[model samples]
Target: MSSRRARFGVFGVVALLAWGAISVVRPIPERRAGEVISGVRTPAWQERVDSLQRGETVGGVLSRGGLTAQEATEAIGAAATLDPRRLPAGMRITLGGPEGAPPSRISFQLAIDRFLHLTRSDSGWVEHEEVLPWATDTLVVRGEIARTLYDAFDEGATELPPGARSELAWNVADIYEYRLDMSRDLQPGDTFRVLFERRRGPEGTVRIGRVLATNFASGTASIDAIRFESEDGRGRYYDTVGKSLRSAFLRAPLEFRRISSVFGMRRHPILGVWRAHRGTDYAATSGTPVRSVGDGVVVRAGRMSGYGNVVDVRHANGFVSRYGHLRAFAKGVRSGTRVAIGQTVGLVGMTGLATAPHLHFEVLVGGTQRDPRKALASTGGDPLPSADRPAFDRLRADYLALLQRVSTQIADSN
Candidate 1:
């Protein structure tokens, strides 16, 4: 019995030695650097890394990391405590195993500071908060009006979004309150441009800020720029090179005109109503320009039943003016368009039950309409600075001389 036991033991030793030799020669599989080995004997570390990168949100990251939904949630919770709800739309994550072996487990961390770590859960990317950065850039846009200002903006060439055109018109009126009245005299080929600031949001939303500059050109006359200036520490509109744009009185008080049965009310030419005449009736020549008597805003511009193509402007210091019986409107002339003393607003035509072409012009103090022709209280004069008057006079003289030369040349050609 002892000899048989010895033989069995010897056989066992031989078998163990043979196994050791085989192990020494063949060796067990080992992981390379940056590689992970799993108990399932699969090379899943690379797949997991790829999955995490493809995830748009935290939850997606965990699922791609080879974790079940619940497992990924819990793992992500433990790793970053991020809230899935607050996760950003386009975030990426990376994962890696310990060196020299397949990764048995992995973890995640956020690099962007805006991401707020939330509670962890069994589900992937359970909770998180994302904060956005503030914007500090400025944007500018310029446009021209040909034929009509509204049509130019509304045609979508300006590339502004909805409601931008109205806002732009308002800005022009606000800045050039003393220069342009868009109702009466805007010719078919008149042109204009504006400058302003734009703000953008993190979500790619955009909005316009304050208007910085504006230019309006008509015929041979042009107002180059309307800008903000500080003189004596007081800010006001100045020209392109810093000159006052204000004047004592506006060039014209009414926007556009045509002769509508003369100044007297005789049998109410069109209405047949017997009423006392209070103002002159200028005939509207369809597409004629309308000018503002003074700098003001269009408090009203539209139809008033019998008055057709009516426009009313409210000026500074309790002054108001009205224009009626027109054919069509100038570009950008609306309820809030600002006008200078001589700015053209609309064209002339016989509208609103008019018997013939003519503008019904009226000036109002407080709220009562009065005779515009008689109400001419000579206002608006040069704003030449007392200290700079001499210089301005000299410049003006030189400019006049040059203008005369050009005029003579043109006359010679004619």
Candidate 2:
């Protein structure tokens, strides 16, 4: 999240950034170019569902659902690997047969997308790990920004999982991080059309797949990004013509954190003076991962007056970025070490003159401090590799047509 000189504390900003490794681990499976898929699957074996009650054991659920006591015991034993003791109340359990019968299988969530599937084997009940079978579909949603992008999509968000909602915002912000300051640039009347892959299960659980393409428009600013991958399996967002949507630098080194302060004249938080604030402050919990916004070499990774622990990365085009008030530098990251864009360089902290944990981020162009927002955006990078162009161009045309249809639908509705 980016905003003009914010009054929110530093810790508020950095903790706001990342949703954790869970975001990547659960990402919707990537689709190759020209793949067209849109629909939900209805599995015939999804025959029953029951809720786990407080103080109810797996054996109890099994018995109540029609398994004989001995069968329940054997099934529970087989599911021991999942530690049934930790089963949360209200957990939904799906079965492969109707009530009053020994189901062919019992499935319970292990985590997002993962499940513990208990089945009857030749010898006895056995447990097997399973992941939900997803039916990927194209989801077209258009919303006028009321406050944040999340709020725009809040109408039907209750049906989606917690991670889905958080990831939707994260993905949207990530796609436009370089082009727009999410914390500040999103306007109330700005409208967005998101064309993405939506994965649904037989029981109706749903998650955001991959963001295939996005078109966002505000008063005067607009951005369009299409997801594309190369033969080597490296996927990134690119524009219609295949220009990389990624700039050489990231808008912020951290995830969803609000901008607590910006680069400009301001009242110093500690010094208590009307002075020039040379850096931006992102509030976050201590130890939130701080990243290098661009590929560069660490120029400094230590302390300075009022700056606390710091890591400065020097990039090409006479640009240098500083991350102060770090809890610690990332291992093996020090002066002269090469770093890549979005690589962890340090952790947020309050090691220097600060009241709370936060990352003090600054960007210097030609050795002069500039607004991190503008400085990061100026580094627009290159296009897709020449070899990937033909594939990307074909994909781009398809996506643009889909976006056009969505826009037309919106116009007709209005």
Candidate 3:
């Protein structure tokens, strides 16, 4: 038995030695760094993100990101659509290529919804601007006016993106400019409801789109405006009955601002005498654009006594509108020049006999100065035609229903 066991052990040792010799003669192949294992290939490129520093040029940024000076120049040349030197600080940029090698592709955000991409080709680098899509959502916002429309919007649309509330207030004021002077007509208890489009981009940025409908109530007066496109394919605000919201004359010469002085008896800031003040004074910053209230011909565009740098426009039906305290007259705004409504005629200034920067607006009937608010209130834009009444009615109903539903939801939530 002992002799048989010894023979089996010897055979086992011989077999192990033969197996080790065979392994050394024929070794298995080694895999490369980016070789395909099974079915998936290892990625050849890596991505690096960076932000543009203050006062840094595009070439400097590219060079700092492991790119040669020649490659940076080529990339800058490819970006013809944008000025590389004007890129804002903190703008995000992305580079993609093999690790430790020059980037073959680069991309950067131009705006919240715009991107610029550059890629290497056989000849040189090519570039293209990309416009990102935005998804739109209709929402209703309601607020009460404690001071001004801008304040009310800020208080009500708290979740709105920055600057959106101000934009909405301006748009709403524009819609009601014909019927209501937003600068002064709004009372403390006045309330407004707006139904507008809110657009959201892929990066979660928000912006205000079209205002579909709005309602503003002050005292016993309630005004409603609905957006409808006419046969000319232009969008205009109209009442429930389809009467356009635009008037022959805008309510104010400057955009929505405070009224420093009104018509009638008031002590002049410069003269200190209680006398007849024929026009309304709108307090605004210097250089604010002053617009023509109506379409008219420039009868006067020069300096006058106490009214520094004035522009007088003669409209239809013996009406003449005057803009005073202008820093400079707009180009081509001379005598006999025809100007359109809402056109920029001059910039606000304290050039003449004015104590501070303000726009003095006056409306003349025949040759007598009259109250501008009462004189221009009766004028209105064209009403919707009978053929388009059905479309207007349908749109009005839908938007009003949306406003009501949202208001109810808000009340319940509160």
Candidate 4:
């Protein structure tokens, strides 16, 4: 989480910007109308860059780039692998050909990792796809909690790409969901450090990739997580001793948010009578996504008396979790639908027996309601297999060593 500004080393910024493989592309100039000049036709290699407008079709983009109707249709047909309507607005397309003639080459980036090339052949047009390589670098960011993790990330990750800090915070919280509740566990003086991947694509777009290693410290308690993949082919985070960070259930059903009500005897907001509150209420805005706290099949998804719209998921451990006051169920979520941990199931709402927009979450064991916090805390994660311990140990050692090197550099810089 974030309070103190993390040290983003000057070298890291310079190294990221100095990727030798990344180069700026310039447009080719237009040539004069061809007239026999010195009996040798001067080949006019004209290039134009056009962006796809909103609600515009591929044919429209081709026509605007000087392609005839017939040529545009042929080009579209040649690139049948790409869905023309699926192309997002602001996608840049490059057209190149002789001046005053239809383009011979059409190019566009389909995604950060994919590029499409359409070229005119002797018989017809042909399409070729290219994979764009990204320049990747590992960087370190350290922050101290002030008010919340979001604040810490906003203040500390100034060197990160716009909008990336928020994503990083969410991802960090997700990695430790079973071990820590970001909304309540972190204090003002708590600290966090991360070693993460920064990738830059051909368009100079920067994004946060994988988190290689991270550590969080609150008072005398500290937790360190390192990324590792075992022979089982599943990649996950583990502690220094190789214990997994993932548990059967998440600490909470929603992302970091304020708790409006806790489980206990309380006066009913609607009935105005003292009663047992069998669930925890999380105060959140309507339309905010609510996720399943664990892997389970939905046993029920319909309106319940006083609960409004609700979903009941039955986990493998015979524990049933209930989410109530949902605005709408996510697509494909219904009775008998299997859901994975952290999968979105509904949206927060105030439909029945509620005063404001909030989620009423409950955990039931043996057909009886239990405190979600205490129930989830009783679960635990698995440890690395003895056969895979050597590989995990090697990865953890290397990652920690790299993290320490960066910490030393930060200390030296200050």
Highest-scoring model, TM-score: 3
In the range 211-264, model 1's lDDT, one tens digit per residue, is: 545557777866644334335655455564446766544424443122222345
Task: Give model 4's TM-score versus the native structure.
Answer: 0.75
- Once fitted onto the true fold, the runs of candidate 4 whose alpha carbons sit more than 4 angstroms away are 1-45, 53-55, 121-123, 256-279, 295-306, 311-320, 329-340, 343-345, 363-371, 407-414
**TM-score, one value per model:** 0.37, 0.67, 0.80, 0.75
Clashes of each: 64, 17, 0, 2
lDDT of 2: 0.76
Query: Per-residue lDDT of 1-414 in model 2, one digit per residue for the tens?
Result: 355335455656655654465466575588999986687654444456787999988778877777788887778888767777888998878767633446878888766678888887788877889775657666666678887666776642444577676677678788877777676567788888777766776677777778878888888767789998777787799876677877777777787643343333567778887877776777778888988888998989888988989888999767999999898999999899999988999988998888788888899988899988677774455967898888888998888778767332222111
Candidate 1 regions with alpha-carbon error over 4 angstroms: 1-28, 31-144, 155-157, 229-235, 240-361, 364-414
lDDT by residue (tens digit), candidate 3, 336-409:
99999889999989978788888888999988999888888845578889999999999999888887765522
Q: Which candidate, 2 or 3, would have the higher lDDT against the true structure?
A: 3
Kindly list the per-residue Cα lDDT of model 4 for residues 1-414, writing each as its tens digit: 133233356656766766643576344356688843457677789999999999888899899999889999989998978888788999989999988777999998778788899999898999999997887777788899998888899887887864888888888888889988787667899999888877777888878888889999999988999999766776799888888888888988888643433334568878999987887877788988899989999999999988899999999989999999998999999999999999999999998888889888899999999977777873347888899888788888888877766442222111
The candidate with the higher TM-score, 3 or 4, is 3
Of the pair 1 and 2, which is ahead by lDDT?
2
Candidate 1 clashes: the total is 64
**Residue 69 of model 2, lDDT score:** 83
